[model samples]
Target chain A: MTDASNYSLLLDEIAAELDIPPSKYAQAVQRYTSVGEWLCGDDNSDCMDDPDVYPQGSFRLGTIVRPLKDGKESDYDIDLVFEIKKEKYATTSKEIKERVGTRLNNHGTYRRLLKPEGRRCWTLEYSETDDVGFHLDILPAIPKTPRTGAIHITHRSGNGTYEWSTSNPKGYAQWFEAKNITAFITLEKTQKNMLFESNRELFSSVDDVPNQLIKTPLQRTIQILKRHRDQRFANHPSHSSKPISMIITTLAAQLYSNETTTFEALKNIVFKLDAHANLQQHDFILEKSLADQKLILRTPDDKWIIPNPVAPEENFADRWHENNHERAKMFFQWVKWVREDLVDILAKRSVAQLTESIEPFFGERAVKMASSRLPFLTAPGIITLIPTNTPHIEITNPPKPWSK
Target chain B: MKEIVERHFQELVSEFKYLSLVHEEPEIFSIQGNIEFTSSYSEEIIHDSYNITIFIPSDYPNSPPCAQETGGRIHPSFHTHNEGTLCLASNIETVRIFDENRTLMHFVKALLIPYLHQHSYYEKYGKMPFGELSHGAKGIVEYYGEYFNTSNPIITLLLLKIIAEDNYRGHSICPCGSGKKIRICHGEKLLALKKLKPNSFFVYEYAECVFDGLESDSIPTELKSNYIYKKISNKNVWQHRSTTHSPTK
Candidate 1:
């Protein structure tokens, strides 16, 4: 077929490789549910009255990617909100944090799996021996009054002092869902039908298949962007200042306009975000549009604001103005990188060229996976023509030497 | 310092299994190793390996380490300095890359591995993989000329002067004779280069460029009045007098 189609197919394959496998997804759900039941189970004396446990973050959003730690593929971090029905002001942050810790400590299995207390959540590490291992970060939270689906989770500063931090994962998810509605509506039936057909033994009908398993182009695009961000900052000193998954997801969701393909969605999102980041270089129309929407705001004093859609007070870019806007600078640099690595490279290059171009950013395994699946689409001869050691063109901005 | 060096060495050795620590002193740490790479795409096996020694100074993360070809496979013609250290990249480039990923593993993977691969590719093909640059001062001028997107060395030097002084006036006249403002011309590039390092670094680079121009007799007549030329001329005078007064001669 054409090179554009090949690029799209290659992206789809790479994103698929990065995605959480169905078996792992099921295991995550089962494990988190069991942990939830154990917390509110009758055996525990200090169990909460009405404890609600559910997956949040990427897991709930269906944008999970196999995380890389120390440059190696590590466990999936499944964040679960172990929220309770208690009044927010009735208890202290320390008490809620301790209550969850104590309950998990009460269980022999959970206590063994439980890591040292995190700043906010209690981590349960599932070893790789358990098959496609994952970690569940159970956030102990109490409901925030007058704000629907918002909860005040505990935060522990470096000085070992605890404070209440407000988050609305549920509300954020709803906002994301609203943005993804058009694409979701278009793809839901077919995805559920496919799911039911594949797992005939588990589901009685297509309707019985859970909605979480259905992924739209928007979800897949977020997954790819997150993986790119992770790889870009893998070993860099700017790792701490790298663009966070929340901002990536939020921007992707906002820019996503029911693109039918993952490649289209990702390209548009990166292009638009790059334009938004470097507004002065772009056209006045885009600047006016951004100003009208106020999605990404730049104040007169050079402060940046990327507000949380659900909680307007919680700026995703709160730290962007700090350290001479290092976070903001790095975010734009990353966008430039994504633009180069993903969009520019994939424009009209051959399958082999595209694979080689993306290998450094997406890693060899994903590239190999994409390459292996390419012969069916393109001629085998084209695939065999992959160069062993192609020379790079002379770089435009070459580095200066010491003596010379 | 020793502990930090040891830790970085350990990290480097962990990822690169063939590399091992050879020598360790308070100020210097060395590792001798062989790196191997085989292409994943080719069914017909192609493997390249190189034996090398890496010398990391105590003040690393600020300064870059040096690598030498212990196997003598790579000739000096292939970008090795007269002292036999592999010219993997420009010092400032190394600092920039290392700053981005301040890990020994990244140093080896990003810089050393590519250098070796380029050398090996050159050996097999009888040409450099990525085109080569002139050895000493001329290469630096060529690099900056490309960096500022100006073929004229004079414009490049002016941009370097701006960077060295850290005085970027966006609304000032463009140095490229474009008759536009600096911001409309090359202001963004200047700002980017400025952010890469401090003004002091660019000051040294500017002096080096001037010295290079003088040595090659390539300095245009207009630059005779430039401040960099005056600074170098003063230093040259002091050096000439000091050498003339040496009694050992």
Candidate 2:
């Protein structure tokens, strides 16, 4: 057909390839559910009352893209919040963290799967097969008072000091869900039918498909942007300063206007972000009209602010002002790269030319997989042009003169 | 209107496969994405694509959708405005084509695709395969001249006056100076033009043609009225008159 369709189709294919496989999703659910049972099951006498384990972050949002490590697709990171129903004043942050770690160590399989404790979570690594696997990071927490779905999780600073950090993963998820509702409603039925058709052995009917499995355009847009970020920052000297997934997800969801396709969603989001980047390069003033709606903001002192929608106090860009605004600089630079690589390249290119241009940005494997599906490449030869016998549209009326 | 827009989007997505609904408002609905096409007559595989955004007004078939090139490949030097608004076809032709088939699909197939094809051909061959019109008021005069099949600007102006006033008289003499009655001469063409657009549209076009002809000294000074002359002297008219077609790239 045309370059517009070809470019978008290729991007869609790449995103589909990057998404977490069905088997892994099922395994992640089973593994985490068992962890929840062990923590609060009746068999364990030391079990706390009403402890719960549930997914958070990208897994909950359905925006998980296969992360990259050293230019190779790596394991999926499944984040779970193992929140215990207790007052924050009941115990110290150290106690809650140790309690969860000790409980996990109590299980034979978990003890074997467990890695060293992280800054905020206990990591459980699963074995890799066919170069694909996933790991679970269980963050030990207790509910924060007054606010629903807000929790105070344990954190260990670089100096090995333990403290409490407030997070509202559940509240954030609810907000994201609200933003995605419009597109979700439009695509849910069609997505369910397709899911059921593909997984006939697992699903009895379209109605049996889980709501969590149906991805809206917002989710797909986030996944695609995350992958672009991953590849853009891979092996860079300032890789640690790359824009985080939280910031990307928050901005994308906030700027989303219920666009019905990933390409449109992404183009609009980046177009606005590029505008902000251009402004940031100059005066960095907050326009009065855009002040309330701006996704990325700046303080009076020129510090970056990308506030968490659910937890207003928690700034997703907390580290953006550090190192002479290195994070902010890189974030804008990445936005520029995205505009050039993904959006601008779609203009005036053939399939082969597009493939070559995207290879360096999205990685060779992903590009190859995406290009392999193109019908143009699959067709035998150039001889397969529109047959002469086929009826073609004719311009019966004379051509008209055009003006501005 | 919403149902119609939704159906149009679905049909577009089914064919283009990449275009997605980008915006939906009470007054406007927009779809943005890439479209791929191959040259019909080319023996070799010549694939090309463009990124476009189409804005369909709520009035829809009554007021045709506007398409813009978002790819940054086309410049104003091509048949587009500086802001990338494509000069797809002359206003009258757009109206006539839409009148024949009042569907977004027909608009894309008949006007949008061919316009894009012309660009592709021009970019490769350094000349527009389909000849182009001049810009601004000059283009309007040229379009009417060609439509009425006459080199004389006065005759074309007279024909437009009849359309603008809705004063077609079959018993009257033809404006072409052929010494024949209007019914047997340009009557069919005039009637067809009358159906394509409202009288106000023709009035604007008639005024535009007069303004251009007066500027070029083709029309006599006696024909210039105080109202027309005063409007033509305005800054907006000068701005419209200043537009010149860029040389072929």
Candidate 3:
């Protein structure tokens, strides 16, 4: 086995630099909660006692990375799924979208921030701030039951046809949370105790603990991977169809062995993810006509699918079939890049070499800042050749070969 | 030679705080210690120290010292040879760079430190930072490529094959694709190289990496006589796994 200390140290430094600061996280929490409160209180819409205005996506999974800037703005996408009672299940998609849009438009604070209605969610773009700034994508959804298993929401297909589409954000988030509950709990206890010691008023009891406040190895690994993916594909806007967050989260969770260290977890998850895909191939039923040699992601039973853990009908790999498996190819390419970068970084000794290896994955600024935090580290100095008086070996010829 | 060896040992013990000369003689001297290596500029300790021994041969400055990790905590990527001899540099490189006037400090800082750094790094991480040079023949070809200032491994292989021969007539074409006579082209360099690598086995080993294998006639008489073909075993399930997901696009 390798020493593993340097690897762990480097990952820890990257995580410390990348993870959202507690103050900024709290600000984001306050902003999104305010949006939720405003939607419920507005008399213009039918947002009653508990109109499910909770986070979904990365924030909910506790794998949120500081988003890249868009032009002059550094915007965070805080996806808040707003689900009301299913009393009006037959309501038109347009009507459902407009209802939430109308409520947000009427609110004094939200009126200026409300963006033009999109196909599905109503975007509320917040202005930039010093540390953090984000927009709330309020997806107006109606759940089958109040507990959130399956749901119907507005979706805009090509040719601008708005219609009811199926989704299960709450179920998906709950399933993701369950993937590493034990590790989360252990991390939660340590983090909470630390917070309590610093300030007892921060959290009263364990019951009120917020998941986002604690960072688990699994969570940090996902965040780092996501950030790397974002940077990797920043230039290739066309391949924006790269593997989505849900697929990455699901695959990572499936392969994560709850390794205590972020370095081990990241390495294990990345290596095991491709292997898990290979396992998926073995389990999948083959087509008689089509050769089953290549790496294909599909359901073992019949049709190609990366089924949502919450709602099996919703295939997260929906685009894979149409895109000619470009997504699948790109996913593995990314995994290879991650592995190589990790290996190169850990194997490097000098700070310059370390920075050079990591800059490609985690942006230049992030690497520079993270590497600086390493203790007793000295920058590599330029070497000037000093003439030496060492004696050289006298050149001699070997015995003549058969005179060719 | 004895004065050169003694002087080098003295320089090493003086410069490196953790090192001290243990045994000494006119022909051979041995030194062992905890080598506390630090970065060039920062001078900050890199990591867990290494317990090592340096054995200087009678040839002194003409032949570099044989340094080894005596602690047995060596990483495979460190290129530690049998009996813990550190493969610090290629044989030709050692000969070309070795100088009689260079101090033990010069040798340790230039050769020994880098090797130990690589060992430390490989211990922490499973891979070498700058990829390794394979030992023996393969290594000779690699160094020869750099020594000749040619990036093409094929040409380097050819150069080795040609150099392994005893005579090159003045009118013979150069192996470098230059139509000029060998005497007018690379004759001087080839004559010099004869001192460094006298064997043509390096060319065969290098050829195997570049192509499938060389024909018997294509191999030099020295190499072809001793060449033994080893059968390759079938790939396991992991190799097949790569084929299943091999990037198509």
Could you say which candidate leads in TM-score? 2
Model 1 Cα RMSD, 1 decimal: 21.9
Cα lDDT tens digits, model 1, A346-368, are 42234454577688787788878
What TM-score would candidate 2 get against the native?
A: 0.66
Scoring model 3 with DockQ, what do you get?
0.04
lDDT of 2 by residue, A248-321 (tens): 99998888998766777888888888877755664666566556785787877868889888777778888888
**By descending lDDT, how would the candidates be arranged?**
2, 1, 3
Judge candidate 3 at residue A386 and give its lDDT.
20
**Taking the tens digit of each residue's C-alpha lDDT, what string does model 1 give over B1-249?**
667677888787654544567665557678765555542211222245566778886677666788887644566666777788888776666776676677677677667766665665566667554566566756776777776778888777777778775678999998888999999899987877787787657766766665554344444554433444334445654355324332111
User: Which pairs clash (backbone N, Cα, C closer than 3 Å) in model 1?
Assistant: A404-B136, A404-B137, A404-B140
Which runs in model 3 stand beyond 4 Å of their true positions? Answer: A1-3, A43-50, A70-73, A88-90, A145-148, A158-160, A195-209, A274-304, A321-324, A350-352, A377-404, B1-249
Model 2 per-residue lDDT tens digits across residues B1-249: 777878877776656654667555565688776666654533322356788888886688687777898776776778776556788888887777767877777777677777777777677777665688888877777777888898877777777777776789999998789999999998989999998887767756766667554346444443333443343345564445424411011
Report how far off residue A170 is in candidate 3 (Å).
1.9
Where's the lowest-lDDT run of ten residues in candidate 2 chain A? A382-391
Off by over 4 Å in 2: A1-7, A42-47, A282-290, A351-356, A371-403, B1-85, B88-135, B138-249
Question: At residue B214, what lDDT does model 3 achieve?
Answer: 30
Q: List the residue pairs that clash in candidate 2.
A: A1-B36, A1-B37, A2-B35, A2-B36, A2-B37, A3-B36, A3-B49, A4-B34, A4-B35, A5-B34
Please report how far candidate 1 places residue A164 from its true position, in Å.
Answer: 0.9
Interface RMSD of 3: 12.7
- Write down the lDDT of every candidate, Cα atoms only: 0.74, 0.76, 0.62
